[model samples]
Target: MQTRSLWEHTLTFFPQFLAALKEHAPRDATVAVIGASDGKFVLPLAAAGYRVIAVERDPLALHGGEVHLPGTAHAHATGLIDRLRLEDLYDRVQVVEQDFLGSEPLDRLCDAVWTSCSWHYSVNHRRPLAEFVARMQLLVRADGLFGAEFMMPVEARHHLVDHYTSPEKLSRHFTGAWNVLLTLRTAEFTERAHHGRLQDHTHRMGLLLAARTSDHPHPHGKKNA
Candidate 1:
């Protein structure tokens, strides 16, 4: 999906997202964005004065996808960054291609972890639900912000988002160790397949912002040791 469309259809509360990062994450902290396909969100974020590290598994995400972005044929990930001169920004947005479910974990912890519409993939590919939480714990530290936007019926995280979406149900996951900050159940959308596509689709969505509690058990951000 095009980044612009993703922003319009799903990411409605950009303000809350900013607040989460500013309040929970440290100043000049690095933001690790899961599913950072083609710097769609990364470029704007980097320009906003935060260091960004985009992680994507799709090979095309690094370069460009099969379908070029509007107004250009070489509208790949890195190409967009270079074109917009976002490359001049410090910390130089970095995009890494790796499976989030692989045996290896990230080498470093982040001040904020941004996973937009990508959590379902972890649930589908990775085994137990606890494993998914454990992985996040290791990658994110106490007081760090964890943001997500996904479809409803995340109880199993098995399939992709289609019609089932309940913010009330999804908000339950942010309790206990996590402090649920913002849970806005935005309007349902009939999104399109892609740029210039007339195919409309309906999806249930939940936007969320949560922070790991200070007494969140694990000191180093990993549990079940």
Candidate 2:
């Protein structure tokens, strides 16, 4: 399956994602979601009464409106927003179609910054990870939160997988910028033969979740001197 299709599959279990979200975000907190594919994460936040801004890099996908998940055809992200008659809910959300790395700074501080399954494709993974954590540190107020869910490897070798980052390497990248809240690895199962074949050849089936420390200094507007 394509990356888009994989994301669609993942969005079906909103409850799983929500459980994690609640652990990190408070009620009525402001949130910024980067690389928000079809808006799956954004819709839930809207429903839960949190202010959300979802940014996507693919204009075609956004304009295409909604993409139903495979098997169940469940609406996700933009579709969920529309199905729930929550377009007005967008008053609280700001969905933008632009490269997350190249986008302008957000207008206000958020309670949390979330990047679910979106950081692996970053052009310069290390620099962007640093910049992303630093940016989130600036976007989230002191005592606020920053979280990410990444596709990582159990071992340090790059498989035939599309993208893979080692947990240890990722931890080193965030060293002082964020606290390691949770790092759980879950197996990814595939019913399709090709997917299973790919998985067999490539060890591409693990997830990682990490949270940013609250005390980190905001990297906003600091002189480079």
The whole-model lDDT of each prediction reads 0.61, 0.57
Can you list the residue pairs that collide in candidate 2?
Answer: 39-77, 40-77, 178-213, 179-213
Stretches off by above 4 angstroms in model 1 are: 1-11, 68-86, 121-130, 153-165, 193-198, 217-225
**What is the C-alpha local distance difference test score of candidate 1?**
0.61
**Model 1, residue 104: displacement in angstroms?**
1.2
Q: Residue by residue across 36-153, what tens digits does model 1's lDDT show? A: 7656567767767777777777665555445643455543334333323535653566666687766487777777777666655534444653455456556666777777676655
Q: What clash count does candidate 2 reach?
A: 4
Per-residue CA lDDT of candidate 2, range 1-225, in tens? 111322343323334445666777677777778876656577667768988877777753455443444344444333323422444565767776677667776767777777765666646364545666555556666555656666655454544343465555556655665665555554654334221132233233333344556567655633211
Leading candidate by TM-score? 1
| lDDT score, candidate 1, position 164 | 38
* TM-score for each candidate, following the candidate numbering: 0.73, 0.67
